[model samples]
Target: MKEIKRDLEKFAAEKFDLIIVGGGIYGIMLLLEAVRRGLKPLLLEKEDFCGKTSHNHLRTVHGGLRYLQSLDLFRFRDSIKERRWFLKYFPEFTGVLPCLMPLYNKGIYRKSVFRIGLPVNDILSFDRNFSVSREKHLPGGKVLSKEKTIELFPSVDTNELKGGMVWYDGCLTEFQGFYIAALKLAVQMGAKALNYVEAVGLIRQNDEVSGVKGKDRESGKEFAFNAPVVINACGPWSRDTAGIFEKDYPRLFKKRKLLWNVLFDREALSSHALGLRSKAGFVYFFHPWKGRLLVGSPEKLVEKSEAETVAPFQKMEEFIRDINEIVSGLGLEYKDILRVYPGVLPAEPDGSFSGRPAFIDHHKNGGVKGLYSISGVKFTTARLESDRVLGRIFRHKKAISYDEMLSKKEICCHSMAYDWQPNGEDDLEILKKIIKEESVVHLSDLILRRTSLGDNPPRALAILAKIRSLFDWDNKKWDEEVDLLRKQLREGFPNQKPRGAGNR
Candidate 1:
């Protein structure tokens, strides 16, 4: 928190080569890249970093095997490369996840098809596990007999259950830590970032974007940040952020698609992630992460404006019903859901590209200059997209090698903190360190994103009073914080109702 205040002062005074609005994964990664290449950069987030779409991801670094179905070898290669890069660089935060797809006597999901497809997948991602640690190595896909499938997923439907195909993909054990670690690295590399700051409008000169008009959410003090180039990487709020520029590019903004996932504590799905097709024919992932089963299928498109978006409670029930009806013997009920993660990603009305384009709309192409907006989709490819965006902006500049960037004296990149358990029960010391270093402005930021406590509501709420005391908040301040967190939890995870609601 103190560091954020100091950086805010510094940001107000300096002129940056690049100013990025939105501190989601894309914006964070872009800031890291810009600083690595010796460019002055500033990043502002309206809320806490990775508090939205980036934090609600399925936690998988997909290897693009899905693209093989469309015969898109280029995309397959790109996905595999990004997957391998993350596994190699952030070994502490990621690992290889075993994914299973049950085979039936049907189209695409059959042993015969996998027998051919698995080898093709292996050929396409031949170097997927190259130079990776032995424990993190992703072996080639293989077919499992029906008996073996039943042993792994005990509740498999016996009717025409031929077998299953197993493949390996990367999974993030601690997504929030990875994102914050990236931002910290950027800071060490001379990048400035401040959360709870919003770009309310654009500072323009002669119809060209020259800077940004920002308002500190806490202080309500407005300031202008002068920059030659400004990038808008707002995730779900892309449309609203673009509106600040006062430009009407009708197709420039699209309604965001809301993807929802329900977590079950029973571990009914076990360790492996299962790919199951719903009755509606949409593919849903059933994976066990951190002792919970996560399930979700087709993404629901939001009918309301982004600001008014909220996941209806009915959707959570629907998710449970859909999974139970399709997969036999797994009688999951609404009460079984421990939490719900519903997040949005921008998309065209026709559902084209699915918000994966990184729409680097250099407004010069549409009348306004020095302004760009990005629509990020997948979490797995954020780094790849950042490289592309910076490549275009700094095309002629001499590029710095990854090795050189790491060798810099100031860059102190470390493995994710939550990747391994602490040697002792030093909760107070750990909490104090997080509050001091991680820009924890709100109680939810401290619990939800900074620590693992937020995942378990009982434990989090039990320690709320202690956290309040540690922060030295008055009763009124503490109540306000708890109220804000309650509102957020209700909308974000309805199952984990307010403290006294007894919904659980």
Candidate 2:
């Protein structure tokens, strides 16, 4: 990775085939596609990778099951295709999550309507030739009796409830981790990907994009990169980045908006993800993660500038409060909350969401002949989205397909089946011996980032003494890291009050 960074530094001093702005899922996916085609692309991010809406997503790899009302057959089909591809290629990061649509008397779609719709969805998926398993992948949906619905979700509002429907979908364990892995893969494939670098403006020549000029946010140093093709894949900021190029030259760009929110709670709702409808709109998927429940996604229109705006703390609290009221009306509470966040979905001026039909436009008349803009799409469908965009950009006779690297067996291998491995006695003994020799501080470093133990502080420190002896670190470094961790914990949780204050 360090070597890749150094190479990027050298490349930035010269011109390149393509330079991609934005390090979100879309940008990273495009970078990977370019690298796979031997393009050696350069990728830039203004913040950490997946630092925006990607990280803030509800984590459901949905198939647009609700789009039937709008009759967006194209998007619905695209989502189905993308969902299958993600499950096939990234099984280690994805899973077939059971999803329940709790039917209510006041809902938009009735039981018979859903029964008919499920078969239609299956037929569309089949006609598209997508490899979604009818038996295992979706199970074609089933009708649950009112008693069964209450049995499944004991806290559901029975007055409003009218049985339910069960189906299958996918969910990600760690949204940021998956994208970061993709970014790392891009770096590994000889692509230049730098985080924390801001692209201040476009480098134009004779009214076309030549490259970009920006400074390193960490070092406060200026730099320039030259490229024949510059792609704007900045998600919600796509328009803003395009404006930088359009200022000196006339260019075309459109802006659209969508919003999502994540609420944390832990009620005894079914383990399956739930998609429900309310008076406002469809509320999709309340699922458990890291000991908390996440529900979301209220769609609304907003100015492009407000793309990365955080939801008001009170607004988020109110959202959870409303859910709690519904749950409590059936019986749950507000004590379940842990956190809240907001996300944006960029759309086109025609009131169409980005990524469904896929947008790939190039500015041939601009000073830079190959300036392009690729926008809109969900994370699950990232690979397909990239394939379409790159196909337009390269105009190649043929390009590699995701299937060449991914297979059903490989996908299953990567899934949760391999996540929890039990080490034998010999391995455990070796680990203990290594820990005894290395010492606690070095062990802390190893376990914190390298292993998943850092998510829980108590478990993280429990093995510290064992790890301390392995590295043979004296007390000094151990104490230093411990103090640093303590400070980090305190700073990371500014709003959390100290325990026992209320009782006092």
Candidate 3:
């Protein structure tokens, strides 16, 4: 079976039941669901699949415990069902994560609040363990004593401490690998996916959208993909992309808010994911990720033009300051941040992120038929929302078997850190595998997307020559590719340089 490939000529030649305009997690899941339901879906990505805004996730598969604050049990249970789907389907890449939030008598963080809330959360999601594997079963919520909480995590603040709340959720062991696996399954099941294909505009026939007009980014050529239905699943760019329609319809996406997370070089502070409230009462999560600390979710309202991949310097500084204020003992400096993960989410009129996964059938709203756009809120529920919403359009009696889809082996991408090092026997072999099969177009695509080599700059810098040896680029092209890679890396860490790259 074909792993992800860029055969725009072949893809554009085929007829499709549906055309999806983004290759983020939502689009990927939608394409897979479309295939499982016996629909021919073609997905187009402007860049490498999941290499843009969608790649910057905090890696937590949320179960919506926070929604319990407002007694939004409907959403909470929906999150539980979705979280179970990930654990049950992708068991190898996802697992149960123990979550702890220290109570400090702050508004909702107090023990008295959770004493009643925990049991209700348990009662509502009682069927959470219904079909999941024995190893992946999630235990009910619990409230720990102040001393026991401190025993489990000593770094939490003790001033006005009211105890701790412990619960379980799912976390992606390998974020990119899990996403790529889904895409691979979609490809195997007959969904057409091509990256480096940009959607220039829509092709409409009177009151209906017949296809999408696209441009191949790899080659400067234009093409058309004709489908009965077109879906705009471009995450943050949905609003801007919808502008191309230029119809007298309601705006598909409202103003968006910038949400960011910081990956500190320090090791995990505790075995469980810790949620501590700042002096200003905003709660922040500092979780243990691959032996490192990952803290998140500083937010700001930004206009459509101002949405960017990196958070502003002052905003990030304030975010780190807030984190330091909550846990002064662990002074996390800016230099300690290895990477900054940023993305934008559709916000309420008041800039709050309290919305659900939303979609607009432009046919019903104001524009042409067969044109629909979706604005996704969370990654945890992308699969659930995709199935629920798309089922309305393509109804069938056949049930989708997760075992059949996930169990079948396909040629998928894997992290090359184990094999891409110096003196490794398969250094060249694995690099060739990624390039030959994984739709690699540039050196940065190989380093940043197909593998996790870019996660560690020094190691990636050291492996440049081996990577170069696999490609046939000469002189100017190699230098240009290296310069592009450096420019992309510098966006995350402005001060990052080639450290110890030549030492070997």
Q: Candidates' TM-scores?
A: 0.91, 0.76, 0.92
Order the numbered candidates by TM-score, best leading.
Answer: 3, 1, 2
lDDT (C-alpha) at residue 151 in model 2: 82
Q: List the residue pairs that clash in candidate 1.
A: none
Range of the 10 consecutive residues with the lowest summed lDDT in candidate 3: 493-502
Runs of candidate 3 with Cα error greater than 4 angstroms are 246-251, 396-399, 407-423, 492-504
lDDT of 2: 0.60
Q: Report, for every candidate in turn, its global Cα lDDT versus the true structure.
A: 0.75, 0.60, 0.78
Model 1 vs. true fold: TM: 0.91
Clashing pairs in 3: none
Model 2 bad stretches (over 4 Å): 1-8, 127-136, 205-208, 248-258, 263-268, 279-284, 299-308, 329-336, 347-368, 406-504
Candidate 2 per-residue lDDT over residues 1-504, each given as its tens digit: 212252336767876778899878888888888877878788888765665666667777877676766898777877787777666555556667777777874545568777787777767766322454443355556778889978877777777567888876777764544664565566666678766677887887775667887667768776888887888887777767776755321222354555655544344267777776554554645775544466776555666465245454444455555565556653333333333335667566676565452354546543346777766557777777788888888887365565653321111111111122324565355455323322222333334322334333444455455444444446786677666544322221224421211121
Q: How would you encode candidate 1's per-residue C-alpha lDDT over 347-409 as one tens digit per residue?
A: 687864463554656565665688888777788888888888888877876657665765443
- CA shift of 405, model 1, Å: 2.7
Better of 2 and 3 by lDDT: 3
